[model samples]
Target: MIEKAEGTFESVMRAVRGVTRAVAAQVDDLVQRPDVLVVEFGVELSAQAGAVVTAAGASAQLKISLTWNK
Candidate 1:
């Protein structure tokens, strides 16, 4: 049982690390670009019962919502 739980935790951590790397890379790319607008924020949860889930689950999301003048 302990071994199975450890394996699961390791897998989850690996996934989280991968996601963090991808996000960092994307943000770096946007930073290098001149005409890139990035908006990021986190959700503030007041109270929760059992499982109150939201989109991305209170994460830091980057949104590029801008149009270039052609």
Candidate 2:
């Protein structure tokens, strides 16, 4: 049970890291300068361990505010 929980946690962390890297790459590739602000980043995870099942999942969202400087 503990091993499964650890695996799930590691998977979640890797997903978070990948998302962060992708977001940063997108920002770096922008050719036009725009005022951008990250308003919120959130992650929620839940797990259920039962006699016959072990399930885990996560939901995440990111909100950003952008203004055109032109």
Candidate 3:
């Protein structure tokens, strides 16, 4: 159906936009809709060579929603 195709196109567009934003942004915290808030964060932690390492130097954040919304 045409509606299904339109929906798919919109979904693809939204995903592309999200990817573009994630790449072009450092900190992304915004409200997705009236009842939903999407916060995407990426961080990099660099530890001194002599210090203990808790994580890798690079991190990639993904889209996540809080439990309260559910």
Candidate 4:
């Protein structure tokens, strides 16, 4: 995982610097419990290398959980 700010910035730039991207995302579903909530999303990222890119492909999909002490 990219832990530092500089590394994170570079990671993002590397994906975008030389590629064309069509990005889409949707929240597909969620689960709720007494103490927490979780949500999952579907994401589609279509990437094609531009003239400056040698080879590149990228997509991101993730789920998040939120919780609070009662």
Candidate 5:
């Protein structure tokens, strides 16, 4: 039982880490691009674990807008 609980915790941590990395990358990209005027991102995650089954899923959406200064 302890091993199963540990595995579930590890799985959840990995998913959270992945999401953090993805958001960091997006921020880096926006910072490096001089033409970016506005940016937005949406992230969602779902997980299920139980004695009989385990599942996980994630999704993300990004939007960027740019305009000329002159």
Candidate 6:
């Protein structure tokens, strides 16, 4: 399972990219074994702060959870 894959980036898009990469890595690891059946995948994005000044200053957090039935 993957959890708390959080990152601060220059923009929300970048942050999402980071989280996506993290999740993909985890999924790739699971799929490599050939016997794992990935049953569920979940992602949670935390609420953004109200006062985002600029794209260069934006931040985001992500949580990823994965469940497999072996």
Highest-TM-score candidate: 2
Q: For candidate 6, lDDT tens digit of each residue in 2-39?
A: 22222332344565566677767767787444434233
TM-score per candidate, chains pooled = 0.45, 0.59, 0.36, 0.27, 0.46, 0.38
Task: Tell me the tens digit of each residue's lDDT in model 5 across 1-70.
Answer: 5565567667656766776677557666863544445655565545656432235455767666665554
- Clashes per candidate, residues 3 or more apart or on different chains: 0, 0, 0, 0, 0, 0
What lDDT does each candidate get?
0.47, 0.68, 0.51, 0.42, 0.59, 0.45
| All candidates in order of lDDT, best leading | 2, 5, 3, 1, 6, 4
Which run of 10 residues does model 3 get worst, by summed lDDT?
A: 26-35
Record all residue pairs in model 6 with backbone atoms less than 3 Å apart, i.e. clashing.
none
lDDT of 1: 0.47
Q: When superposed on Cα atoms, how far off is each prediction in RMSD?
A: 8.6, 3.6, 16.9, 10.9, 6.3, 10.1
lDDT of 1 by residue, 1-70 (tens): 4564455556556766676677567766763443544444332322245432321133234344433454
> Superposing every Cα of model 6 onto the true structure, what RMSD results?
10.1
Off by over 4 Å in 5: 32-70
| Model 4 misplacement above 4 A | 1-54
> Which segments of candidate 1 are over 4 A away from where they belong?
32-70
lDDT of 3 by residue, 1-70 (tens): 4564455556556765787676445333533332444656454445457544432243455665533443
Give me the runs in candidate 6 sitting further than 4 Å from their true place: 1-10, 31-52, 55-59
TM-score of 5: 0.46
- For model 4, how does the per-residue alpha-carbon lDDT over 14-66 read when each residue is reduced to its tens digit? 65533322121222232333355454544343335442222334455545555
Q: On residues 1-70, what C-alpha lDDT tens digit does candidate 2 reach at each position?
A: 7777677668777877787788777777888756764545687767666531146567888776656766
| Reference-based lDDT, residue 68, model 1 | 41
